[model samples]
Target: MSSAGHLYLHTPFCGSRCGYCAFTVEVGVLDRRDAYTDALLAELAVEGERMGTLRTIYVGGGTPSLMGPERIARLLDALRPRCADDVEISMEANPETVDERSLAAYREAGITRVSLGVQSFQAGMLRVLDRQAGPEQAVAAVDAARGAGFESISVDLMFGVPGQTDELLDADLARALEMGVDHISWYELEIKPRTALERAGAALPDEDWAADAYERIVGSLEGAGYRWYETANFARPGHECRHSLGYWSADDYVGLGVGAVSTVNGRRWRNHAGVDAYIGTLSSGVPPTRSVEHLDEPTRRRERWMLALRRDEPMDMRWAGPPDHPEALERLVEGGLIDVDADHIALTRRGRFVQNAILRQLMEYA
Candidate 1:
């Protein structure tokens, strides 16, 4: 749309907030959903009027499935005009909220993909993470999506939680693969401040144990025929998420609704996190953008490299900066961490295990 073809809509309501979640989401606010959607529509209209046709639309949040069909329809109606015919329309849902009716409504509203947050398949693991859904719901959700004509579906799984072992995580992976979804995203649980997990003082897997589990999971997934396309994402050939790809590739996007962030025309901005403040701003005939960052070339380039290196594809060696940094690159390669060939630097299996550290080193050297 406009100069960019990506849009993100933030729906910040959930039945219950996950303990480890740091997203700016509100729980127990379904009563005010109608008003919230109205404000969101206003925000979308402003962005759509400025942006013409989008290539991707990602409706992500606390739990988008909790929104009724009418709410989803109204949001899509505002977005339809701003999207190209081949736009990849995707939404994120928690496993517990998905049902036949919701799945049917999503397809009717032009959703080409669905990403279910099925964090873990074990009932005990789910309880430890404060997730509402268990293994049965995760399996049923995937089945329902496929039955409802969704060609592309993805399941999100997390590892390295307290009391979780590599063997237990391996079982979760096997169950997910057996569910026949098109994609998988496996993430390790991170303890952030202000979360229930932190407040309860839950014990986490040791760093070395976490690393071992990650390595085992990666090798297991690859062995099971899933492609590790990005740091936390795997897919069956063509099922990689287009919306997320746009982000990792540093493509432009516009975010709507409260607490949503967007990068467009080389500038990044975030909507106001407060609902009343966001609604008030829109009532004043303007967007509720609370902060904006106009990224310079070096800043953009640095971000581009950082994001690109997350994929299996290598960063263009020409974009890697100085030749003298051979020491840094060589060290990473010799450690079985990365592969450097011709004009590209790609991650080896081990590199993805410590991707965050490697990227930090590259940024420092650059």
Candidate 2:
């Protein structure tokens, strides 16, 4: 039993398969949502009791919006008593599923933030990505969530798809800004192993193109008063997702439901990703966990460094490397890639582009 204040719950249900997604998700499983929620509550009763108290919770998913209002409310009812008074609760929803009624229900259930998955606003891009949502639904969903009393709203966008273009992405950013969303997740579309997109073999953009797209997005968002708070997250002032920040800060958190992962006191464990196997394990009176790891001090330190360097804030003094790092911090500072202060070290706008190479060089002296 540990007192981690952050929690993550995974719901592995989706209405249809998105071609580029490779997360452990089961499509067209609406009929089994009740049983799935029951298993989750059971896991909570057992594990949540050991989790001390919670300050933030993120309901991530194969699209949690698929669970609908009643089930979402029931899940929240179980979590309400255990949460701190000002806990930040975020739920992930898809644009197609984000109706007014559903948004209102989620707000009533204590969801303060709703992250809409609007992969691309272009019809051709959506078709290539195999998403059912259109551009209009994306706008309507954002408006509906704001109208439903959600204090914070974020939208997800993707780049490097087949039909993605500078003009298309620029328009998407403009639309997100026009809608007054407080947060934006602008990321490149990675073609991972075994994904439908990967299998189909349609050529996506090259690395250089993706890099250019990233720069354009950063410029557009920054011009609109959005800060690049993390590697792939941007937000207006006071709208940064605290739950997401917790991950970069390495705060202890407990994860629930099939395929969820948890970290408590430097120990890591992931639940079984298979739905039946997860439910069956719990039914047999054992935890549904499938794997575990104990992070040693060096690994933990390196992880802290990596995560910190990828964030928007300054690196804590404790996490900073030796007096002089291998990468020649002074040289990088001169080159305008990074900055160091008595209290913190942070990446500059230029450093964000080559973060991996810079981090590797710095870690050699860590």
Q: What TM-scores do the predictions have?
A: 0.93, 0.95
Candidate 2 colliding pairs, count: 0
- Candidate 2 regions exceeding 4 Å error are 320-327, 364-366
Candidate 2 CA-lDDT value: 0.85
- lDDT against the true structure, per candidate, is 0.83, 0.85
Residue-wise C-alpha lDDT for candidate 2, range 286-353, written one tens digit per residue: 78866999987767777788877779777875654442263577787888988988767888879988
> What is the alpha-carbon RMSD of candidate 1 to the true structure?
2.2
Give the TM-score (vs. native) of candidate 1.
0.93
The candidate that achieves the highest TM-score relative to the unseen native structure? 2
Question: Candidate 1: which stretches are off by over 4 Å?
Answer: 49-52, 317-327, 334-336
Local lDDT at 8 for model 2: 94
Model 2 clashing residue pairs (backbone):
none
